[model samples]
Target: METRTVVAECIGTAMLVLFGVGSLVLAGDYINALGISLAFGFTLIAIAYAFGRISGCHINPAITLGVLLAKRIDIRRAATYWVAQLVGGIIGAAILFLLAKQVPRLQTAGAFGTNGYGGRSPVGLGAGGAFLAEVLLTFLLVFVFLTVTQKVALVGVEPIPVGLAYTAVNLIGIPLTWASVNPARSLGPALFAGGGALSQLWLFLVAPMVGGVLAAVVHRFTHQRPVGQAQQEQAAEPPRVGPWGRMRGGHRPEAGGPEAKGPEAA
Candidate 1:
């Protein structure tokens, strides 16, 4: 079960980087901000459906870190996920580079689409601006993820809520910080872009992870453990009563029992 979840996280993260960063390498400014956002949002949408059952479809390191800090997942599992996410990001970057090699006169576009601040920013925003944007955006993203994935009375298979939430987040954030709610999304790009991107990588990773942790902490205050964990605890506890409770000398009656003429017989 744990293996499946980890696998899903790795695969989903890879898919996200492949599409989102892939677009950056294939189409420079032509892909535009909105298109890039859609690539990310759509990848999340697709992953939600594909891996939701296995790992709740969390492919972002910031998200995983946030949830872990919130105490949703144990340390061991969270560490495994973080490792998977990093490896997956590197792989996705390599793949994007490979695909970029096929294009003509597209050298500049062949980056991993890494997120950066200052001069590397789409709008040339500084580190402070980028940090704030990442913090706010990722906070919203994680909060929405917690709510949408919640199993309410009428709400089941929470993929749509999460997917739509991501799309909406992207719509508002694409113009700013290129909407990197997920750190790994920004990381793949930096690996290829280097220089400015490499220098400013800290903000992209730190801000989003911070935002995620904040959201997760808030989530914990409002709710108990996840349904799955609760169920596991319940299952682990011993049953209250045993077969003896239901056997021969049980409560009042015996197999050949007669009223024995209660007080009236006396």
Candidate 2:
């Protein structure tokens, strides 16, 4: 990958952790879990549009794994993204850790926005619930991305549904497991929060990957289109207005090309 691409991924991932985790740690008392979900979801929208063309804006390692399993990206590139994302997560958490120390209550609180289950969980959810939540939530997020970003339909406005999907999962999963769904996102804060956050970290990591792989399989069966057919469809279609006035390929004319003037020779 190009250096610029690597840097974009690094910066984008860092911002995700910075804003997403920061919202939960700093303003969580004020904004609550729903607001935190919007923070992460909106941050995803900003980064996806800002750096999406450069590196596909896969700030989450789980997303990268899903895309890799879908064969949308090669193994080597996926590895590079993983490294960049992990480093970015650490950097993001380090910054959050430093800032959190300034607050007297947060300093001793040791939250750092880490994810956990059972005693560590906000609602005392056990291992099984947290594991299931992570898997199901990650699966939905990845499946939406795989489906929405395709060339067939809703071509240009992928970021909207993709971001909304993240928000929806967070909205439901926050109280249960703090909405992990991304290993790097979880690992970064766990390093700082330690204790049970570190001990229960394995569940966050393993379940999300399993969910991503399952999403990839489901995407292949439900949404995958043959390359040649896709190309032919694109050629047959004409550029038309999509959401937000973006140009996207629309269906071809029923009988004639765009230049054809007569409607049934009337």
Candidate 3:
């Protein structure tokens, strides 16, 4: 299970960065942000649905950590997921590097589609705004995730809800944080951007986790079931065993055998 989850994260994040940054490499002079934001949103749900049964395919450390605190995952497994996400991001960027090398302008910069802040922002947004944007965007994503994976999970049409919620997150966050919401998503781009992107990378990592933690805490306290759940559980069982020992507990006497006092007839 552990190994499969790690493989899933690595593969999923790879696909995410590949298509996501690849879209950027191919972006025209103007519509880069719009196109890339859409890729990021849709790719999130695509990967989650594909590997969700395996690793829950978070593809984002902040999401993974939030789930961990909500008691959805153990620490060891969460650590593995984070490593897989980061490594996958790098590998994705490396492959993008190889592919973009064939292009003209992209070859020089190897525009593997990097992330940035301050003077580097695509829209010229500042660092402080970017950090806040990341925190809120990732928070909304993790919160939406928490809703879908609940046991006795919601009925049909569940995936659409989570997917659309992610899309909505993108709609709001794109201008400011470039709609990162996922650490590995930003990390890969920052690695290629280097310099300021690398420096501001800390904000991308820290803010999301902070928001995720806060959302988790609030969700936990507010989403508790009524104490009557115990009564509802008790009401579901059938009547107890008659002359037989406790319904499911003690062993029953063997028929026509020693315990039944008829062994000689055999």
Candidate 4:
């Protein structure tokens, strides 16, 4: 509930949509899909390093949901982050829309970098294909995020893998559904684009959330619990007595023993 954290999330999400979607809205003709994809990836890397300490730089509602489901953050914090991120995204898109309007002959009404399928899709992918593509693409991003941010992961280098995973998903997803792995990112531009973008918005929102949930479920099965969490869980359990009356299950290692030293002892 820290005010600064919420502000950071809002500012971070705004920067993401501004730079990532702005690259497309303003410079898609020059930079093309690869450049746009890199824009999104690089923006994420910068946000992660800059605000990762304060807010973890979720920026994306789907990512926040994944973190929440993983129990990394409580519901109150997650809801706060979601609101901040959505507001930030809309603010960013609004800024982009104004900038685009300044450019001569630039169109911001129909597309405006909004995600879509069917005719709006680069490859004309159908609704079902787009939904599946978004789910799988978002799954990869969320899964990488969950795995790389773990206690076992190398500190100070999580952004590299996460950004790279984002770039990879975008590379494959752009032609299909414009790579809407983040619902906040998609909703922002769609609000401005209106028309078909509004109608098709449901798929982008629902698919990413489903993917986040799946990522959390799979992450639980794949990664071991942090040592401190395991210890806490053990401490909370009632102690049991064996046949000989020795403490079992919830017993803690004797003080100064090797077992009592935890992972640091290794």
lDDT of each candidate versus the true structure: 0.71, 0.84, 0.71, 0.88
Error of 4 at 261 (Å): 28
- lDDT comparison, 3 vs 4, better candidate: 4
lDDT of 4: 0.88
Task: Highest lDDT: give the candidate number.
Answer: 4
- Which window of 10 residues has the lowest lDDT sum in candidate 4? 250-259
User: Rank order by lDDT, top first?
Assistant: 4, 2, 3, 1
* Candidate 3 CA-lDDT value: 0.71
Higher-TM-score candidate among 3 and 4?
4
Q: List residue ranges in candidate 1 displaced over 4 A.
A: 28-31, 108-111, 151-156, 222-266
Q: Model 3, 1-266: lDDT tens per residue?
A: 45777898899899888877677665634555566667666776677667777777677788788888888778988898899999998888778767777777654242245545666666777878877777777778888777777731223445566667777776676556556677887788678766666777787778888888977887787775556977898999764654644333443434322333367533
- Model 3 — which ten-residue stretch has the worst lDDT? 251-260
Q: Mind giving the per-residue lDDT tens digits that candidate 1 earns over 164-210? A: 66777776766666677887777776777777677777787789888
The true-versus-predicted C-alpha distance at residue 97 of model 1, in Å, is: 0.7
Summarize candidate 2's per-residue lDDT along 1-266 as a digit string, tens digits.
Answer: 78877787788888989899899999998999889999999999888888877888888888888889888788998899899988998888888888888887675244678888888788999999899889999999999988877531223578889999999999998999999898889888989887778888899889998899989999988888766988899899765655644444432344334433369534
Per-candidate TM equals: 0.76, 0.82, 0.77, 0.84
Off by over 4 Å in 4: 151-155, 225-266
Overlapping backbone residue pairs in candidate 2 total 0
